[model samples]
Each structure stands twice: as C-alpha cells, then as structure tokens.
Target: MDRRLRSILKELIQAKKALTSKFIANINQVTPRTTQEDIKKLNQQLLSHGASIQSIKGRGYHLHIEDEQLFRHFLTTALYENKDQKQIPNTPDQRVRYIIQKLLLTMDYLKLEDLADEMYISKATIQNDMKLVREHLSNFYLDIRVKPNYGIRIIGEEMKIRFCMAEYLIQRGSDSNGNIYDGFIRLPKEQTDFIKQTIIAHLEKQHMTLSDIAIQNLFIHIAIAVLRIQNGHPVDNDANPKQEITHTKEYKVAEKIVGDTEQELGVIFPPTETSYVALHLLGTKILTTADIEKNQDIESLLDPAIYELVIAILDRIELEMHLNIRHDRDLMINLGLHLKPAMNRYKYGMNIRNPMLESIKKNYQLAFQAAVHAGVVIEKYTEVTIDENEIAYLALHIGAAMERQKLKQGPKRCLIVCASGMGTSQLIYYRLKTKFNGKMDIAGTTEYYRLSTYPLDDIDFIITTIPIHEDLGIPVVEVNAIISKDDLQHISSYIAGTPSNVIRDFLQEDYLFLNQSFHAKEDVLAFMVSEIESDDLKRARFLESIYEREKIAPTAFGNLVAIPHPLTPQSQQTFISIATLTEPIPWTTERTVQFVLLLSVKKNSVEDLQPLYEMISKLIEHPESLQKLMQMTDKASFMSMMETLERL
Candidate 1:
C-alpha cells in the first residue's frame, strides 16, 4: 500500500469517532477527492484482508472488520514489511521524524543517497531533511558529524545519545507497559512486561505510588539501560554517588527491582545502574495527602535543601506573579517532596517524559507560566536547565494549589427567588444545585413577596425566575423556570469575576497605543514605561523589572502577542497598557511580537486578576483576533475586538 493509504488506514483503526473526509485530507495534506480515492483504493486492497472502510452518511468514514484474525495478520504483515519496499513518508515533517528515529536507532553512518533511496526521495530532499535532523539532535546535545567519502553519524556524549534514543525511538501515548517493539529498536514485549510488573509489585510492597506516566518512564529507563548495558555501554562507575539517594528506602526498592530484572533478563547490572534506577524512583514518586498523613514526619523524609528549594520556588512565583500560593502548606510540602527526586534526576542528566505536558500547558496556562518562573529560580540555584516536561510536572503542583485556593474561597452565595408555587420553586432550586453544585451555595429559596423580608447580608447574587425590580446591592440574574445553557454561562461569568462590562473598565484610551514604530524589544519597553504616568524612579525600576522578568523567560507567548510585566509590583494601582507595532519585532528567536500588553499590578493587592489574564491568553492563542485588532486604527475598534474575545 502507498503511504497515504497506510496513513488513512491507521487513522481509521485508531479513531474512536467517525472521521470526516476533510479531517483525513488535512492530516494527509491532500484534497477531499484525493482522500476519497485513497479510501476506495484501500478498501479494494482490504477485501482479502477481512477489513473495509465504511462511509457513514452525514458523518464520515470508519473501519469495519469482517474477520479480526485476518485483519490482525494483515496489519502485522503490512506494518513489518521489508523496510526498503515499505511506503515512504509522504511529507517533509513525516520524513524529518523518520530520519530522527532512523539515525537514533542505527549506529552505522547513513549516506544521503541511501536514505533518499529508502524513502523514495531525491538526494536534495534528504539533505534538506538532514538540516532539520541536525537541529532536532542539537536539543539533545548531539551533533551530526559527516566523514568525507563515508556518511553522516551522530556524535555526542553516550548519556545524551541514549537520552535522545529514549525520546525519539519510543512512540508516545502507546500502551501502559512502555513497550516499543513496534517502533525502531524493538524490545521484547515479554521482557518489558516483566519489568513493568516487577516495578509495580515492588512499589506496592514498599507502599509507594507512581502515576502511570511515571511508571512508563521508569519502565523505559530500565529497558533502555538493560539494552545499553548488554551492548557494553553501562553507566560510568567513576561518577560521584548521591549519598541521599543511596540511603533512601527507594534505593532498596530499586535494588530489588534491578536484581529481579537482571536475573530474568540474564544481564548483570553495576552498582551505578542500581543508583540510576533509584534516581528514577526518587524522581517519579507521587506524594499524595494520604501518604503524608500516614507518616506524620513527612517533612523530615525530604532533604533539607530540597525543602528550602521548594520554599524559594514558591517565593519567586509569589514575588513575580503575585499568585499568593507561597503559604499553601500542602502545595509547599508536595512541591518540596517532588523537587527532591527531580533534583537527583537533573544531577544525573536524566529526562523524565511527561505525556501530559502539552495538555498541562494548554489547560493550566497560568500555572504553567508561574511554574516557568519557578523553573528559572531552580536553574539559578541548581545550575541545570530544566526541560518543559519537568516544568509541566511542577505546573501540576501549582495548578492544584490554584484549585485549592478556589475551593478555600468557598462557593458564591446566591438566593433563588421564584414567584410561582412551591413545586416550581423546588424544581428550579434542585436544577441549579445539580448544575452548579460546588460552584454556588444556595442561601435559601424564597418567594418574591418575602424576598424583602429575608436577610441579604451574605448574598452575593440573586437568581430569580422573574424580573427583580427591588434595588439591592447584589446583582440579580433572571432565568427561565428551567435553567438553560445561557443561564449557566451567565452564572459562570459571575463566578469567574468577569462582568460583561468589565473589559472597558480596565482598558483605557490613554493606555492604548496603536501602530507604534519599535525596532527593538528594549525600545518598546522604554516607550511603554514613558507612557506610564508615574515617578521617574518608579518608571526606571519598572523597566528594569520587566527586563529581569524577560531574563527569566521571554513573555512572547507566540501568536504575535507578548505580555510583559515586572518581576514585582512597581505601581500603587494596577493597569494595562497596549501597543501594536507597524512591523513584527523579534521578541525571541522562536516568537515575534506585534501586540504588546504591559501589565502592572498594585503592590500588596489581593484582587482576582483571572478575568484579565483569561482575556489576554485568548488573544495570545488566536492570531486572527490579534490581526483584526492590529488593523484597527482607534481605541473603539480595539475595545470592540476585546469585547468579542471576552465573550468567547
């Protein structure tokens, strides 16, 4: 089968829902007609394979299996056919990924002609792909060295080579056992399963818990270590040992796991290998509240340095973002415990794969940004650069603290008022409770006639089935007898502290700068600072703080948007200043900025800034909106776009 057909079949096999023709075309980078033709060709070929593509009316296409055994056999044969005869990668992106995996798996130098022939591409295409391969390998500290008249080979530290191999060779989001036999550098499924079961059994016996992703990470580590050791590349024995890791109970558990793995796999592991396994254990352990409760002296279990490091991280986050999570004891303890093993991993140059890294970044943008700030402090102290995966794990802890803060603030107090009889009132009350259970607290249900007599001191809002005419300080939201999606949205907006008219309240015409000429980022900062009507010292300090924050990490979060702020509050009042450049300026190597949001928060202010952050994050995510706002020549048009984004 051709690559397009193979790609289509794979998508159908893996899809949980019917896939539209356009979706498949987008994935294959082809037109709908081409996808249809490929589907027809695939179905014709699948006739004898006991599988066929079934097209659903108004929906899309799905895979139908007539004979499971035959389909499985056919899939195995198609996937593992002769490498040279197999379909070539159809796209440059696919070829780049393929080249990386191929180079990481093969020890011998590969000629450009051979790779081009194998992938059924020209030598020029192969050379172009090599450029991307070299760039990708550089991230892992590996370089592609070309020997004249020979070929190109990857050269780097052995540890780094192995780390790159572990990253590229294994397929992500695979099964739970971390098996990679189907990919390049195949490992025996039985051995991988044995190692996974052994690790789980030992961890359970020691009363330790690890997330599935962490377990998968450890499984991959042990599997790769065993393979490398068998290939005569054991970890260096001369490296200094970590006394703290070797003394922990986790080390003993690692010892048992390595012993069983060695016996079962018929390989000898050095003491250093045991320590390496222990490092994974230390790095991946999840400290739950139950674990802390079971051991009253949980704080004593961690290294003193690790505890202090966590404190310093939270302090930096508080100082930089004003997140107010420094005093969250649970967050502090959990983050401290997590850092201990993480530091060990960093010391040994080990990378822990986080499958949820992208999801974490998307869903917990604020937390992830704060964690990035925390990561800068960690790197300053530890002298080791942290990867996005590790930063994502840190974001998990911080995101939990943010959630706990919301819970601690308690739910919004609202009184439900219904003018109808008791049955209607009861119905509305139960419906609201069911939908907004944890988010809202029902003060009590009362008829409109008795609403005046009822105490409203603690009420934050009044939910009424009829229009409320009484002038009460609290806002009244009117809804139908039965709640609706729109009603829920209104309640959610209130809960999020985003009033419909709130954006205009914060964004001022004076603060909005349109079509500015700025060549450098520093120039832009200076311009923004000069616009702020503050003392000269404060303006200078704010600019310096913005530079400091930029040093921690560039605030250019892609999509032609950048939100630059000071490391700490530099103003007595909070405000936002906006600027749009005539041309995009280089904010960072990977990002360009035309839209700039300079945020200034009040010192010691505890107001919720989530609504403003959400609005900015939305603009950052949607470049079309940014483009639309950029074209606007006045503040009125800009505020209109902001209103549209806020509704979204």
Candidate 2:
C-alpha cells in the first residue's frame, strides 16, 4: 500500500463515522479526485484482508470490516512491520524517501526497473523522484552514482552517509501518531533494542546525561557503524585517530558500550569506530548539574562565554522585540544549559532534531519569532546558521519566559452602553461578566445618550448595542440588543484585545495582490517590492535584507505559505504585503510556495505582534482557509473569510 493509502486506512479505522473525500484530500494535500482514486486502490488491497473502503454516495467513504481477526492481523503485521513486499510507494515524496532508505540500507546498487517494480510504480515516476533524491543528498555532500550494467548506489563519505542515515532512519522511528514506519532502522528489531538499552545502561552507570533525541542519534551512529563493519566496509583509521580520544571520559564509556555489544553479538569494533562513538558522546553530552538548586548563581556555574551568549540574546530580544524577558534568570539558566550541548552539536556538524518544530512555530509564534532573532545573534556570535529545529528548541525556553512575562500584563478595560434602558445595560454587563470572568475589566454601564460623560481616555473599548459612527480614539463593538451565543463567540475574538485587531491593523487591500503570474521566488519578490515602492521601504536595502534572511534559513513554512521578512527593520511602519501566486513555485528545495507574505517591522517600534504571527501560522496549516485565501480575487471575499473564521 502507498503511504497515503496507509494514512487513509489509518484514518478510516479510527473514525467513528464516514469521512468525505474532500476532507481526506485536504488532510493529504491532494485533490478530491486523487483521494477517490486512492480510496479505490485501498479498497482492493483491504478486501482480501477482510476489510474494504465502501463509498456511500452523497455521504463519503466508510470502512467495513468483515473479519475482525484478519483485519487486525493485517493492521498489526503489514502496516507497522517491515513487510517490504506488501508496502509500496505511490506518492512522489514517498518514492523519494523509499529510494534513499533502500540505498542506505543495502549500501549497494540495484537496477532501476527492479526498484520501480518493488515500488509498484512506473520507471518514469522513479526517474522523476531521483531528481529530488539527488538534490536532497547534495545538502550532505552525498550523491548517487550509476554505472553501465551496474545499478545506482549512494556514494559519499562514511560520515556524511551516517548523517544522512540518522536523519532518514532513526529520527523517524515513529511518526507523530506513534505509527511506526516499516523498519525505520536497517538492523533487526531485537538488535536495535539491545543497542538502545546498552547505551542507556552505560550512560546511567556513568552518570552522563543525554536527551532522548541525542540518545537516538548516538544509537543510529553505533547501529550504522556495526552494520558497515559487518558488511566489510571498514572506514580504516581504527588505530590512527584513536590516540586523541583514548584518555577522555567519554572514550571510557564508549569503550564499555562497544565492548558489551561486541561480546554479546560475537563481533569486534574497530578502534576508530570506538573513537567515533566518543565524538558523538561529546557532541550530545549535557551537564548532570541541571537538577541542582535554582538558588545557586547560574553565571558562576556556566562558562563565561555561555553566560554572555544567554544574556546577550535576552538583551537583544528586549531591545528589538520589546519583550520584557531579559531579567528572567530561569530563562537565562535553561537557555545557557541548552546552548552548551547545542553549540557542541554545531561544532561537530551534527544535526539536532526537534520533533516539536511545527507545533512550536504554530502555537508559540511570538516566542518562535524571538528565537529567530536570537538565532541571528547566535549566528553572528557562533558563526553557525541556526536551523528551524534548533530555533524550535530555543523557543521552548523563550515561550516559558513569555508566559511568566504575562503576569505583568493586565486585563482590557471595557465599558458597556445600552440604548434600550438601564435594565438592558445591566443585563448586557452581567452577561459579559459571566463570559469574560476577569478577561476584561468592565468599568461601568451607561445609557447611550450619556456615554460622553464617562472618561474615554482610559477605556480600551466600548461594547454597545447602539451604533457609534464617530471614532472615539478606541475600538467599539456594536452587538445586537439580545446578544446570542453566536454573538458572544464573534465578540470573543476581539473583546479583550487578545487577538489585538491583527487583521485590521496590518493588512491593507492596497498591499494585497491576487493570482499573480510568477514562476520563481525572485520574480515574485521583485514584483511585490515593485508594487509597493515607497520611501518607507528603502527598496534596495529591503530586498537585500530579505534575501539575506532567506539565505540564513528557508522561509517556506509549508502548506504553500512563505513568509519573507527583512533581516532588520527597514521601514518606519510595521506593514505586511501579501501576494498569492497563480501557480505554486519551488521556494526551497524541500518546499513549494503559492502564498507569499512579505512582512516588515518598523524600526525601533515596540508592538505586540504575537497574535499576528499566531494567526498567520494557523492560516498556513489550515488548508480550507489557505485555499480560500489563495482563490480570493477581491477584498470582500477575504474579509468574509476572516469574519466566518472569527465565528468558528
């Protein structure tokens, strides 16, 4: 079964009711027609397994299991195990991953046609996927070599190959739903488990600390080394480079780990491989003193440079982002601790995977943005580009500080006005009191005619039943006299200024361009920059800064959304210029983008932009809203979508 088909089957098995093809298509980022065809193919595979996907017209597809035992066996054995013959690749991305993993596992060549046959895909589809595979490998300085009469094999340095394997194999042992991929590691399940437990036991015995992710990475390096050595692909230098690491603390533990695994498995590890293992240990090791009392001065415990990095990062965040977290001592300590191992990983050119990257980017937008700035500062200080995975890790510490900073934030002060009478005003006031419950501080109630008597400067907003056309230097939400539940829900989005008029504040129709015909990233950016030519933007510097930012990290946030921002504040006003492409273009090697959001922050301006980033992140993940946004040709439809979304 194709991975997408596996995904469909997984969803159907778990769902209590039938699901629409459109719904499934949205989830898989495919068309309804494609989803329907996949469902048909899935039904054929499931029928013999005692379950079939049955389509009900006007309703959707439903899973019907005729024999529970057979279906359970199929689900348990085929879906979750490395049943190579039963699993096939259909999607382009799936095929690319499959081809890479196969080459990495076999470490030898196989014919193209055989690979296509194994995948149950066309020779042409495999060829197309190879282009992407080659590009992906190049990032690690690896390549695929094909010779006459001999099949293609991945050709690269052993270290780079191991790095690639770590990314593709061990890191993806199970997906977010805990659904294990078929043979995520090349070794036998028992051997894999043995290696993991061995590493853990030795680390615990030595009182050395490693995060689960770091442990998994170390496990992959060991597993790869074992597999390579058994295949007679010895990297040599078993004794040549072993001298430097012979006396280290990590070397001792690595020796014990390798010795035990060798003893149990009846094999021997090369001296160089043992030293290599120690290097990984050095790259991933964390301080065991994290559990020490917080009252102990952190600066005294940390290296002076590590202390300087943390304080500098916090100070930069406060000065540039206006977040009051520089004084957070706990944040400083935690950040300092994380950066120590993180810097070592960078020094060793080792990858640190953050499984929570997307969630942090989406839910902790303000913190994520702060982390991006911190990443920039770190790049200047440490001379390493902090990737999204690393930034996500930093965001966790910043996010906690943002929560602590919230203690100083007070509630919005709102005043209620009723045109009907005092009875209606009191009723509206009490209703808000029940719904908000300290979310807002309602000063008092008043009749509409006498609303001018109350001081206007202090009030954040006025909740009124009567229409107030004049601008009173603050927002006014005019709700119906009989406030319905729907009304309250609509009011909830804007009431306490938590959402903070994000849409109305930043988005202007003049800055929006719909269905633009651009084929490349540069063309789209140049066109948007040209359309919004202004003295405030400082066009040349703005474009240069945007490109610089892109070079630091790919701006594509996935699901067709790409946010391009300047390296530093380039304008006097914070503004967003949005452009939707007629067709999606490859914005980065790994991602294509159709929706482009060009954002600029004002120089030296202090504004809370948390809601803006959060809403944008939510919109990026929401296919329905993103689809509408891309399709919208007029401002009315765009506003309508926001209004409808506000209600939801």
Candidate 3:
C-alpha cells in the first residue's frame, strides 16, 4: 500500500470512534475526494487480510475486522516491514515532529519543495506546517533563517540548538524503558553500544556509577557529537565550557572515555566536547540516601544552596496547601539531590525528557499542582522559567511523599456539620460518633458560619446536614440532620474518597456555558473567566494567571478537551466554570479544543479532586466522551453525562 492509504488505514484501526473524511483530509492536507479514494483503496487491500472499511450514513468511516488474528498478524508484519528504512511521516503530527528533527539534525539549508518531495506532500502542506514549526522553535529562541536562493535552516544560539536536539533527536526517540534508540540517527548499534560500554566502564573504574537513564543520555550526546562532528558541525568552542568542571571526577572520566572512543570510532575528541560531556555528568548526578551513608541523613551530602531551595519549596507547599509534608526527610533528601542537578540543567539550559509526564499528571493531580508551585519557587532561585517536564519530575517525588503521608493517616478525620453544632448539630455529631466510631475520627462539630475560619489543616472531610455556600478548604458531605441509613452509607462512600457524591459540587449550573462560539483560545478563556468572576472578586486578574500557566506549558491535553487554570490557586473556594464551544477552537500549536474546563482549587483544600481531574483526563483519552459532551446543549444533560464519568 502507498503511504497515504496506509496512513488512513492506521487512523481507522487506531480510532476510538469512526474517522470522518474531513478530519482525515485536514490532517493529510488533501481534498475530501482524495481522502475518500485513499480509504477505498485501503479497504480493497485489507479485504484479503480480513478487514474492510465500513462507511456509515451520517457518522463516519469505521474499520470492520473479520479475523482479528489474521488482521493483527498482517499489521505486525506491515509495521516492521519498513523498520530498517526511514519512515516518511504520514499524518500532520508525525510530519511536524519529523520536520523538526530533520531540521535540527541538518546543518545545511533545506528547500521547502525538496522536503515536500521527500515526504510525498505538497509544498503548501509543508509550508502550512512551518508556521507551527516556527512557533515551536520560538520557545527555545530558535528560528528558521531563510536565504533567497540558499533555502532555510534553523538559526539560533548553538547551545539552544543542542537543547532542542536533546529533546527532539534524543528524547523523542526513546522507548518505554527510557532507552534512547536509533530512530533519527544513522549510527549503527555496534557503534552506539561501544560508546555506552566505554562510558560505563570508565565511570565504574572511577568508583562512580550513573543510572541506566543517565548512561543512556550520555551515550546519545556522545553519539550525536560523533555524527555532528563528522558532518562538520562541531560544538562551538566558546559555548560556556566550565573550567571548574575540568577538575571534577566527571571530567577525568569523560576525558578517558573520549580518548578510548577516538581510538575505536576513528574520530578526534575536541576539548569543548569533553567539557560538554562533563557538564552532562554533573547535571545527571543523582545521589540517593544509599549513596550518602556517612551520616544517616543526606542534608550534609547535598550542596547547602540546593538543600535550602528544597526547604524553600517544601515550606511554600506546606504554607499554601497545608499538607504538612515540609519535614518529610525522604522527600527533602530526594528533592535536594534532584535540584542540585536540576539547577545545573537550568544554568546550562539543558532539557531532560520525562517519559511518564502524562501519567504523572493524570494520576497525581494534587502532587502536580504542588510541583507547579515548587517550580515557582525554583524560578526565584534559578532566575529561569521552569519547564513543565521538570515540574513533572518533581511531582514524582512529591507524589511519593504524599503517599507516605497517606499511609500514616489511619481513619479519615472530619467534622460533624449542621446549622450549628450547639443545636441539632450536636445530635447529628453524637449519632455519627455512635454509628461509626473507629472507622472515622470525629474531631468535633463545626458551624457553617465559622467553617471558613476553622482550622481544617488535617481534616479529611465534613459531614454537613445543610448545604455550605462556598468551599471551606475541605470536602463536605451533605447528609440529613437526623442521619438516616442512606445518608450514612453516602458519608461512608465519601470517606472512602469515591467522590460519586461530591462531583455535583463542581458542576454548578450557573458556571456551565454550553454550545458557545469561540474562534480562538483567548475568546474561550475570556468567556469562562468573565463568567467565573461575574459576582466573585477573589479571582481578580484571573485570565492573566491562566496565561501565566499557559506560557509555561499549553494545557490542551488533546482529544478535543482542554483543562486550563491558574498556575496557583486564585480562589478561596474551589469551583469549575465550563464552556463547550460550538466548534473546535485552536488552543495550542498541536491541538484544537472543543471542551474547555476551567478548574480552580482552594489553596489549602484537602478535598480529593482526583476524581474530577480523572473525568477530564478520561475525556482527553476517550474521543467518544468529548463528542457526547460537545453535543450536549443544556446543563442538565451535561451533569447527567458527568454523573456517569467516574465509571469511565
């Protein structure tokens, strides 16, 4: 099959929903007729392989497989048939990544028409891609330099080029184990393995060892250096080589490794390249508690400044979120060790890829938020904007600490709430205490008026008979004052953090805007922000905060959904203002969003918002859910749909 037909077939096979011809054409940059013809041709080829394309009347094209085993065998064969060849990217997303990597690797200028010819695409399609290309490059202060007849090449600081290369060339081609494979590089495995073994042997000889990931990173940089130097693109000698690093153990090891590799690969090692290798060693030098055994604690092992930065970050998180993990020694040790190298990355402008970023965001929402605040504090120390990838790495450490905190917490601690604990609230409190004595910790009873000022630092939730108008930085379960059987069961479910009862707390009808028309992300954000701050004054300059987070990283997490919010909490009460656009609006360079979920959380709220974020993450991963959500026209149906989201 041809590239275009194979592309369409792959889309249909991988699609969770039927693939629309228009959507297929938009990605391939072809006419609807061309897409239809391609699908028809693909179907003809798949018939003998036990699959066919079934086009529905009003919906779209779906793939029907007659024999799953046979079809899958064929797919596996086809998938690996071109393993040894360079793949011409089939879809827009693939093409953009390919273009970026190709340009980053190419030291010479590339003509648009030549690239178009190589990818089997029109010049117009590739040109349209360049707009996004330029936007991505601008983040790293890199841009395309086009000469009249010489064509275009990426032009920027050489260091920026290397940073971009580390991401696109090295990081992008990694496998599930975080191993850098030979996807874009032409170097053979024998040569790459030699480089890896050389570094490991030298490091081991020096009584220093790096993790598998760090070793893999070193191999990629060294491999790329060989290729680039062979192509006359050596690291510019003056690009900030530290003399201080030259005296360190990492430098001596790097120097010996370079000497051995020069003999094996038949290439001379430059002094600048040796320093570059040493710099990477310093940036990736992770020390665990096991590595620092002289003292039982690791505070003495880490740099004082980096250790202090970790304390500053923990102090800020405790002050804002009040999770009381500021004194977590494991968390402090890990974060301090991480920041020492992390600051090295920032000082030298290095980019490290976290393969588990999306999973970290989805599974650890609260921890991710805490890490974002930690990144804010890091900015004060490093004077450089922290990247989302870095924040996600920090989230892993914070999430582990949070789990440790959870294990120590026995029963859910909460308050018995009603009109007043002095009145019927006392009766409800006594009833709750008698009904569930050991399963829950009834700290005391609280009144609705005093809920805001009440110290809810370690409180798990509140059992209230009457409704609480605002979020009191704690979860509230609205049970009957008399405390019936069903109410007790509901409270138990909430104590378990099931959240089937608390989801409605976020889906207020006043904040729901359905089927709105928005042509751009700014319009969608402005509409949601205006509705959120209509009567509420706590979220002043809310839009700027949202943009501040976006400037760090775009929140459009694909699959037609976007969850945007301030980097830090802007409201005293946690709430959500949602908007469903009439059509998909361009939200980020790579994604268009039809569902906008503006999430705001109280700074010190102990409520588990994971279920809410899980529902949104489900929307991002499952296209059918987003389509159903975008088709809804009223708040009732929307809430009804959300009610069934936890099961997803």
Estimate the Cα RMSD of every predicted model relative to the unseen true structure.
9.2, 6.0, 3.8
Candidate 3 residue pairs in backbone clash: none
Residues 218-312 of candidate 3 have per-residue lDDT tens digits of 77778778877777777777775757687887788889999999999999878988988887777456664566665665568778898788888
Top-scoring candidate (TM-score) = 3
How many clashes in each structure? 0, 1, 0
- What TM-score goes with each of the models? 0.66, 0.78, 0.87
**TM-score, prediction 3:** 0.87
lDDT of each: 0.79, 0.77, 0.77
Checking candidate 2 for backbone clashes, the offending pairs are: 238-272
Candidate 1 stretches with Cα past 4 Å from truth are 1-93, 117-131, 240-249, 283-291, 294-302, 410-496, 499-607, 616-642
List the candidates ranked by lDDT, beginning with the highest.
1, 2, 3
lDDT of 1 by residue, 1-648 (tens): 767887788778866556767656655656789889889999998989998889889668878999999999998877545434534677666787778777766766888788888788998888887877887788788999898778888888767878887777776665765567434666787998899999999999988888777788788888888888888877777763646578888889999999999999999989888887887787556667676778766457567888778878888888767676888878888787678768878888888778787567556767877888888889999999887888888899999999898777778899999988899889888888888899889988999989889999888788999998766756787888877888888777777677545567567888889999998899999998898776623777889989977766567765567889886778866788999887777686435678899888777655567777777777755544556677679888888878888777
Task: Point out the higher-scoring one by lDDT: 1 or 2.
Answer: 1
By TM-score rank, best first, the candidates go 3, 2, 1
In candidate 2, position 543 carries an lDDT of 90
